[model samples]
Structures are given as structure tokens and as C-alpha cells.
Target chain A: MDATERPVADLPAQRDGQEVIHLDRVEKVFEVRRRAGLLRREKREVRAVDGLSFSVGRGEVVGFVGPNGAGKSTTIKMLTGILTPSAGTLRVAGVEPARDRARLARRIGVVFGQRTTLWWDLPLLDSYQLIHRMYRVPDARYRENLDRCVELLGLGDLLDVPVRQLSLGQRMRGDIAAALLHDPEVLYLDEPTIGLDVVSKANVRHFLADLNAERGTTVLLTTHDLTDIEQLCRRVMVIDHGRLMYDGEVAGLHRIAEVERTLVVDLATEMAPIALESARTVKVEGPRQWLAFPAGQPAAPIVAEIAAGWPLVDLSLREPDIEDVISLMYAGRSAG
Target chain B: MAHGPGRAALYAAVAAKGFRRYATYRAATLAGIFTNTVFGVILAQTYLALWAERPGLGGYDQAQALTFVWIGQSLHMAVAAMGGGSEEELMERIRSGDIAVDLYRPVDLQLWWLAQDAGRACFQLFARGALPLAFGALVFDLALPASPGTWIAFLTAVALGLLVSFGIRYLVALSAFWLLDGAGVGQLAWLVGMFFSGMMLPLNVFPGLLGEVARVLPWSSILQLPADVLLGVHTGTGLLGVYAFQLAWAAALLAAGRALQSLATRRVVVQGG
Candidate 1:
């Protein structure tokens, strides 16, 4: 039977511990009015999330990726009950999110990397205390969760500092802690590592992995960072144009997408493109050349060849990011 | 799981957090007090001139008119009578899609904001309000209510007025859901609030239809009714009537805000990811 043909009332019976999030042909259409000229206005419907269907199980960490305007955020908003779907049905933790948002809120925690949820003027701990009461977490349970988050997120010294005074990474950690004080069953993170330095990114990834391992918290993460997907998500879902493009193992994504690693070399002198068997120079500038090689292969040999044969001053390897992989998928789709 | 007492405590904590959030702006608070005082002096002098021109104008003697000026200044920030302070943050949050975080919270959005606004009102009542009124009293002779009962009644009126003000402002802030930019609505709200809340001129002083309409509008509850209660212009049943008026408007406006919020959440198009 087709997902669209399924009866709306025929929702799967409560399987709380198994499938924590379920969506069937979920669609979100936004009617936007644009001023055509001085007095005339034109209205158009943009189907932000068009007939999207997917689910996440308990203890599974899934990477949700899409290019800009790809409906990833729209789908998350529908799942979180922030935006009612124009069509289809969505359920999280056995509750219809839009119909029962406040109830569902107790079961899920969400963090937006671009913006903070913590009170900017208050101490980080004050915001946590407010969250404690707002969620009505039991005193003892709240303490336990708070202690765990504080310890793991390195929020000990940052608790007393005002959120406005903290760095972006510090504020993000504080936000993550606030979201977890209630021990939510599922976590939706949108670009949780957007602007963090290497150490902070590693710290967040480690903490999230531990969160899934210890508590079985269902994690649905959307990001532009592929390393986050490689390290944290065993299963990755790729959506574009408001539709799911691919959903499978991360390794499978790389196989199908066929990513390339770039070796950017700066030669001591401006020269013709380096002659190498393993890599091909994609672009060349004064004293600089970019070589593209199969990502599956190592970069050491290519670097050694350049260093030994040519006047190589410095070189750095650039991993293909999510955009590259997504464009590759798009190109392959068009060709095939 | 958190029943009656726990829920009430949670709201109180929210209010407390709101209080602390504003308290951090010590410099802003000081600057606000100075501005209120300066405006108070200018308005009082003008009122003095008008009262001198026509004695007992709008049922207020020269002293009573001066009292009105100072009281209006005091309640201005406390009630957010002109409608654009902390609610700007809510507008910005809505525009930037950060309101998604707010909706994710388990608490009722209306009540959470109401509690926080109440906290802001309480903080401003003292920090920006009391000092200006005190300065006004030092500079000029103003009408004084002799009884503690009168003071209590006035404070109760002020609290009710705060609710009405918050209801209007929250509605304006929630407009961002549809407008995607609330600055225009915010400016309109400020204009309506300033004109009808008796911040510009006392509702009593207006002539005929304008006075009658201004006196009954919800904005009147923010300043006019409260000021009247404090000035002993309303006594006995009149006092109860003023309270009832403020209560009705507050209920209606807040319920409207609540309805609009639910409607907005159903159709919300957050600006960005």
C-alpha cells in the first residue's frame, strides 16, 4: 500500500520504545504574498516539505541533511509541532505533534545552532532553573540530569556567567544542557556544530554519542557538516526539494555520492600543473594548484609526489562537504 | 506531573527569572529613570500653564494636574503604556525563527510571557517609577491620598493596568507571526497606546465624543482609570466599577491574544532555519 493511500486514522498503535518518530506523507505548504509592484500583490504557495515520509527508532542517531531551502528545517518544525503540516500526519513518542504539542514537548528536546533559547541577560544556571520548573521535572531527577549535563558539557564554570557574556560555543553548550534538564526521550539538533572550533565540535559530538549510548535518546541531527555525520550518525537521510533523496548507512552515502578529496598545493614558484598519476589538477593559479582525488584513497602519496617532484611550499587536504556530496547526487540524478 | 502548587511555583520562578533578566540592565534602568523624570518636569510645567489658564480644567486643580503628570510618568514604564520595551525581543525572536524554541517549551506561551512581563512591570514600578514621582514631589506640590486603603486600591488598579498593557503588546508582538516584521504594528500600537492611555493628555480633558471613547477603550485602563482611582476621582461603587472595567478589558484582550497565538502556531512560517 502507498503511504499517501494510508488512512489518516490508521496511525500505528503506540510503539513508544521502538519507533519514537513517524511521518506519513507529511507536507507543509506556505502561502507567501509578494508585492508585485506599488499596489499589486502576488500570492504563491511554496511546498516547503512536500510529501516527506520517514521515521527514526529509539537509540538511533540519524543525520538529516539537505541543501539550503531543501525543507529539512520545515520537516523538523513539523515534527516538533512548531508548524502544522498542510497534509499528511506526524507522530513523535506516540503523540501527534501539532495536536498535542505541549504534551509532546515533555518527551523531546530541540536545539537551534543559529539561535539560543537561553535568557541572554540571566546566568546560565538561572535559565536552567527556570527550565526545571517549566518542565516540572522532579527535584531529584532535575538535579541528576543537571549534574550530568553540567559535568559532560563542561558547564561548571559557565553556570554563573550571563549568557550574553559567554562565547557562541559556551552558549550552545548551555542551551544543550537546558534542553536536557527534563530527560527528554528524543533530541532534534539543527547544525549543533555550525560555528564551533575543532575542540568544541569534538566535545559536542562526544557528548551526543554518550547521550545516545547511555540513555537511548533518539537523535535526529540536521547539519551542513559531513564529519558530524561520519562520526555521529550511522544512518543518514538526505532530503532535497522537500523530498527524501537518500536514506541509508553513511558509508553507502559516500559510495553512491562518490565524494572527492582536494589537495590544495602552494608551490614556491608559479609552474605548470604538476604531473601526477594518482591525482589530476583541477585548477591552477600563481604558485597554487588544486588537485582532485578519490576520497576513498589516501592523500599521503599525492602529497609525497608533489613534494618530491616539484617545489611544493605548503599543501592542505580539503574534504568534500555536504554541499559537494548533495550537488554530486543532483548531477548524477540528472545524468542517469 | 507537576500539579497545582508545583505549576504555580513554576510560573513564579518564570516571573522571578523575568525580574532578574531586566535587573541586569542597571545602566538602562538608570537612563530610563532620568528620562522619565525629565519628561515629568516638562509635562508638569505644561500642565501648570494649562491649569492656570483654566482653573479646575478636567476636574483637576493646578495641584491635581501636576499630580497627574508625575503619576503618568511613574506608570509609563511600569505599565509599558506606549508598548515598546521588552516585547521588542519577542518580535525579533519571531522574525528570526527563534520563537521555535519558545514553542518547544512545555509551558503555555501566553502565560510564560505574561509572567515575564509582570516581572518587568514590577521591576520598573520601583526603579523607574518611584524615583521620578519622588523627584516630582520634591520639585512641586501634588495631590496626596491620605489613606493606605487608597494606596492599595491604586496599586491594584496599576497591576490590572499592567495586564491590559501586556495584552495589547503581546498581540502586537505575535503579529510578527503573520507580518514577519512587527515594527510597523509596534509603531501603530505605540501611537494608539500613547494617545488613548492618557499619556499625552488626560482622557477627562478631551471633549465630548473623544473623551467618551478614550475613557472606555482598553488603553484607558493602563493610565486613565488607575490615575483616577489614585486621585480619588472614583469612590465606593465607582472604585469597584473601575476595577471591573479594567478586568473585563484585560480578560477580553488576553483571551484574544491567546486565541491569536493558537491560530498563529497552527500556520506559523518561521522566517529561517
Candidate 2:
């Protein structure tokens, strides 16, 4: 077999902790047919993923972040072998996902937040049993995995309930358990916390954190919630318009986006907008003003400037939120 | 390192799961049995009226005609496995993008669905099939297959008929992979299947060349050939030929279904959930 189609066991040993997931210049173009006018139709090509390339080493948790329709879901689908790339090569655990999907399926788990993989009408335990058989998981291993997941994910009481009856959070946990029952080496979670309440979100986040830390399972997380990235991933990749916009440490994203920190100052009495060289007053109220300064610039200087110029009664510095950083990144790309 | 159950175990599990899934719909099963039994009585009365008018219509005596009506009703669920709509379950999965998850599984999609259908068929055979046939036997003087060999041959023919029916349904569902909205195509398939499969009327009832044409088509193997074997209309060598023809259609349709599925997978565009 070609290197791309090699069996997982035949993978060359890791010299420097080998890459478990690899993509080289992958592209996906969708042909959409639309009605042009009465009795006429037009064909359009949408480039869902454009020449994307990235790699993840074993046991690394990487956050894939982007705006809606930024090709995040498409990329994940390609990785999971649900969609074949129009061009380029992709290997997961040394197997071409599309060409050897069944083989690769044994080594990877996937959960789409908007969909449940469990049988809708079956009880949670029944769905797990079906998954056990579908994947051919051995009885001993199956029971072990089920017990572990149920214990760790708080699925004990929910096992008897049908998946349709479970709350979204409960169902999501069930899906996660189902995906992992086969002991896949890698996991792909797309918006795993979407629409979840605060408590459920925390439970999911905590479970994922423990899973990654304990098993060292490679994880690729795609989510809109910045807190999910902040808590789970140290490395993050930003994609926009089907291109990799940034790939670096999570904290480094703020500097790359060129977003600014905000300084909110409440003056003692009604006053003019605070004027300073280090920062600019972006908004002004009768007794309050908001200043914006480069995120990378020292916040101490901007705060000092604001205090000296205005009758500042209370002042606070707001770090650049991840949401602003990402938006700024997208805005910068569009403008340039 | 390989993990999980072997392929045989996985397939059996899928079939068993499919069976269990349908078994849970006790209410729907009861309703379906009721509808089929009611339809069987009406059709039997119509046949009796036809017999009164001609004594021996389309080569069927009164006893054989009554047997045909009841057996046809019992076999309705078994042969029309699509259950009125053409592969609606599979089509819904394809349209709703749930098929993507299915594609990711290690099992072959067509085979998996077929196994699931087998489970549903088993449930239907016991729940819907037995009752209608028993009800007909109670309410009407139904003729039984003359010998044990005939009973065995009839059962074999019915099994093959189920396989062929599943193949056709699977192929129709695969059309959703390309057409996206295959409801119209599905409707056309059911219409054609019902007319030619002798579900509407026995193929022998068709006049001259039209009857010959209906018998030659694959649809007759789905119901008429099996029913004919059961009624002792074809025996010994002729019965063997019927079995062979049913097997051939089952194999051909399943092969065509598999080929179509392969092509469809290449072009699968799973839409939004």
C-alpha cells in the first residue's frame, strides 16, 4: 500500500511524536444548482475549504475556530471521511480517511453537536449496545468503557431513558459516550457545547478536560464559545473564507488579530472626553468615557494617561475578548 | 490493533436491533394488521361476486380464488416492505444529513439497511402476516397447499421475494442521493411495483399478452410467483423454474442496488440537518 493507505499498525514509529492527523493543501468545492429564472437554471461553485493545511501531533488538543460558513464544519467532515476533498491529501492515524474510512473509523470518534448519533427511539443503554455491536467492541472492553463513561459523564440515571426523552445536555453526553465506546485514538467534537446550559456546559468541559489529560487522546475541537477554547485547548487555529488565518498559542491570537483592549473610566462628575496619546476615547458619556488602545500596548500607560486627564472615580481595564479578536481578524482580512 | 466485535457479530447485531426497533411500535403494527385484514375481506367479497358472475374466472376456482385473496393480504406486508412509501426511512436519513453518520460506520450501507429491513420483515411476518391469513381461514373456506414440499417451496419463494423487494426499495432510496427530492420517483416506483407485483390483481387475470408481459417482469417474482407456488398453480419442474426466476431477480436487483449505492456514495451531498 502507498504511505497514505498504510494500516495504522504499519505507521512509522514517532521520531518526534509523529503527527496523528495531517492535511496537505486540502480543498473542497461544492457545485450548487440554482434556478436562474423561469424555466432556467444556473450552476455555482462554492469553495467550502480552500488549500487548507495543518497537522496535529498525538495527544494534542487543537481548537479550530472560525465564523459560521467559514469551512469549519466542512473541514471536520472531510477529516472524518464524511466528505471527500476536491483536491489534496488527508491522513488520520496514517490512513486516508476517504479511501479507508472503515479502517480509519476504528481509530477515530466524531460528535456533531447539532446531531445525535444514538438511535432516537431507543433508550440510552440500548443505543450504546447497538453501537457496541456496530463497532464490534468486545464484551469486556465494552462493559469497561460503558462503565467508565457512565461514571465520568454522569450517565448512570439517564441510561434507561430514551434518547428522545433526554435533555439536550444529557443526549450530548450520551453521544460522547457512544463515540468513545470503541476506544478510538482520536476525537473530533464540533460545537459540543452548543445550546447547553451553564451547568451542563461545565460538566461537558470538565469531562473533556479529564478525558484528554488522562488518556492523552488527540482531540480537535471546533466551537464558537471562546470559553471552550480557553479552557480546553492551548493551541488554536483560526480559519476564514476557507483559509488558515492564524495558527498559534491561544493568547497569541489577540496580538495577531490587532484588536484593542477597552478602558472604561467613570469620572467623578460630568466632564469632556478623556484625551491621551497612548489611547483614544472611542465613546463618551456625561460622567463616563471608554478608551480603546492596542491590546499589545502596555495597559499601565493607557490607564495612567486616562487617570491624569480625567476626573476618574473608578477605572477598569478590559482585556481583548476572544470574540473581538476573531471578528477583528476576519474584518482585517476582508478589508485588506 | 483491531478492536470491537467481528463483522458477522456486527451484522447480526444490526439485524437484531432493527427487529427490536420495529417491535416497539406495537400500536402501529396493530393498526397495519387491521387495515390489511379489512382490505382482505373487501377484496375477497369482490372476488366472490366475480365468481358468481363467471363461476371460473381467470382459471381460479372459488376455493383457490378465496385462498388467493387471503394469502395476498397476508403477504402484502412481507412483499411491500417499503410499507406504502418507497424507502421513506432511508430517504429521510439521506435528506436530513443523518446518512453522513451512517456512512462513517464500518458496515456497508446497503447491507446494513437490508439487515434492518430483514428485522422489520420478521416482525411483520409474525405480527401482520399470520393474523390476516388466520382471519381469512376462519371467515372463508381457504384452500391449503396440497403437500409438505409445496409448503416448503412456497416459503422459500416468499423469502426470495422479500429479498427482491428489499433490493428494489433500496435502489429507489438510493435515488435520493442524486435527486435530493425523490418523492416523485419513489411514488412512481410504488405505483409500478404494485401494478406488476399482482398486489392490485393477480397477473393471470390480465388478458393474453399483457399477462405474459407481467409474468416476465421482475415485479411478479416479488409476489405473484410466490403466491402461484403456494396455490399449486405451478408444481415440480415449473415450481423449480419459479424459484430460479425469483432467485435470479433477487440477485440481479441486489447487485444493481449495490452498484447504484457505490455510485451514489461518490456523489453523496448530505444537506442540512
Output the number of the TM-score-best candidate: 1
Which residue pairs in candidate 2 collide? A136-B4, A136-B5, A137-B4, A137-B5
Q: What is the Å distance of residue A220 in model 1 from its true position?
A: 0.6
- The lowest-lDDT stretch of 10 consecutive residues in candidate 2 chain B is B78-87
Question: What is the DockQ score, from 0 to 1, of model 2?
Answer: 0.36
Local accuracy of candidate 2 as per-residue lDDT tens digits, B125-222: 77888999999999999887658988888888888888889888888888888888878888888889889998877888889899999998889988
* Chain A TM-score by candidate, in order: 0.83, 0.77
DockQ of 1: 0.65
Give the least accurate 10-residue stretch of model 2 chain A, judged by summed lDDT. A1-10
Off by over 4 Å in 2: A1-16, A256-325, A332-336, B1-5, B81-86, B146-148
Cα deviation at B195, candidate 1, in Å, is 2.0
lDDT of 1 by residue, A195-220 (tens): 89868988998999888877878889
